[model samples]
Target: MPIFGGSSDSEDERTIHHTPKLFTRQQSIHSLFGGGKFADILLWREPKIASTLVIGVSLLWFLMEVVEYNFITLVCHASMTSMLLFFIWSTASDFLNWERPIIPEVVLDESSFKHLARSFHARFNQILSKLLDIACGRDPPLFFLTTISLYILSIIGTCFNFVNLLFIGFVSLLTLPVMYELYEDDVDTVAGKLMRKMRKLYRKVDSNVLSKIPRGTVKSKKHT
Candidate 1:
């Protein structure tokens, strides 16, 4: 049997294992998030790309949330601004006898598009399968956590608009992963203690309160 519920070396699976562990099979923070260019960007391995992404998202959040700009309106305004600038440059180049501006053609690769579509399809199926498993009580802990999470999100929905919520999530994405990576062991220790306390509390409730609840007993009817 594999230790900590991890696969063999041939599987190329790496998992974090130490005292006071909350998640037994959980991969490293980097590996948990796909562990490539995306992981690098999220973990700030490439500071330039990560900062650019943060700045872009922040600018979008400011425009959409604070400025109250509609998405379509924003796109149209940006497009018009670009066209105006290009027109001005073209006219100036002609007047000054300089070379006209060249615009690069943007083409979507067929292989890349197919790969993206297949990835989405697989991910969608995986999520649906997981939901089915959870609903079927295959993972009681996961089901309980999912229910609580949805309930919290429902409460949050009433307090913030979709754009505001997305911006908040984006901000969290930029900050949370890096912070957790920096203090992984400390966070795990705290989480492990909390989990143990919660388990004891749950056991008490199950024995004292839930166990006392009367369950309906079914009777079979017989015909004479």
Candidate 2:
């Protein structure tokens, strides 16, 4: 019996039997790992660390500002400031790494990758809607506003004293995660949706072109 429009029962059975189960399992594993598994881990972990660093540095800066002039205080403040600056730089670098492109070729094919990408895109869109609500001053986190305020304060404090340096550094460190959250949340906006659709179309076209080229030709051209 022919199923769908093409293969007979015997042909279908042979195809099914010949297909490697290992390949299917490997594909599933690759998809799970490649589709933002590490990214999610980093995104979740970095923010908490950044937030803690920001709070600690901000408190130290506040203490330095309140106390009178003293060598010990100055030394402590400077050390804290240095550590805070290091954290800020590290966090920024990590953010850059997070933004690095995940090439689609590694994990997806023309037949199934498009569907996976679309699902992620839809989830991202939902995240974006939530982010917009936060940004609009409706049930927004106090910590978010406080973080921004402290960052501005730290910048201004820099003009008057070195203590503010620590504050600025910490706040800057915190900002990276905040920005990421904002971006992650907005993945479903009109522009984001449009971009995803365009990319999907391009991928489909590219896959079609590749599919038409004979496999033997591709191998020969590569060898030559």
The lDDT per prediction is 0.72, 0.50
In Å, residue 9's CA in model 1 sits off its true spot by 31
For 6-71, candidate 1 gives per-residue lDDT tens digits of 222322223223343344535788876666676898899999999998899899888988898999
The local lDDT score (0 to 100) that residue 76 gets in candidate 2 is 81
What TM-score against the true fold does each predicted structure earn? 0.75, 0.25
Residue-level lDDT of model 2, residues 1-224, one tens digit each, is 00111123453345433432221233332243344533343334455654566566666665667665465867887889977877777677676764433335675468577766887797688657656654664432322443566699877875865656655555664454445446633422433333334434544755797467766534445554
- How far is 216's C-alpha from truth in model 1 (Å)? 3.4
Give stretches of model 2 more than 4 Å off: 1-48, 69-160, 184-224
Instruction: Looking at model 1, report the run of 10 residues with the lowest lDDT sum.
Output: 1-10
Cα-lDDT of candidate 2: 0.50
**What RMSD value applies to candidate 2?**
23.4
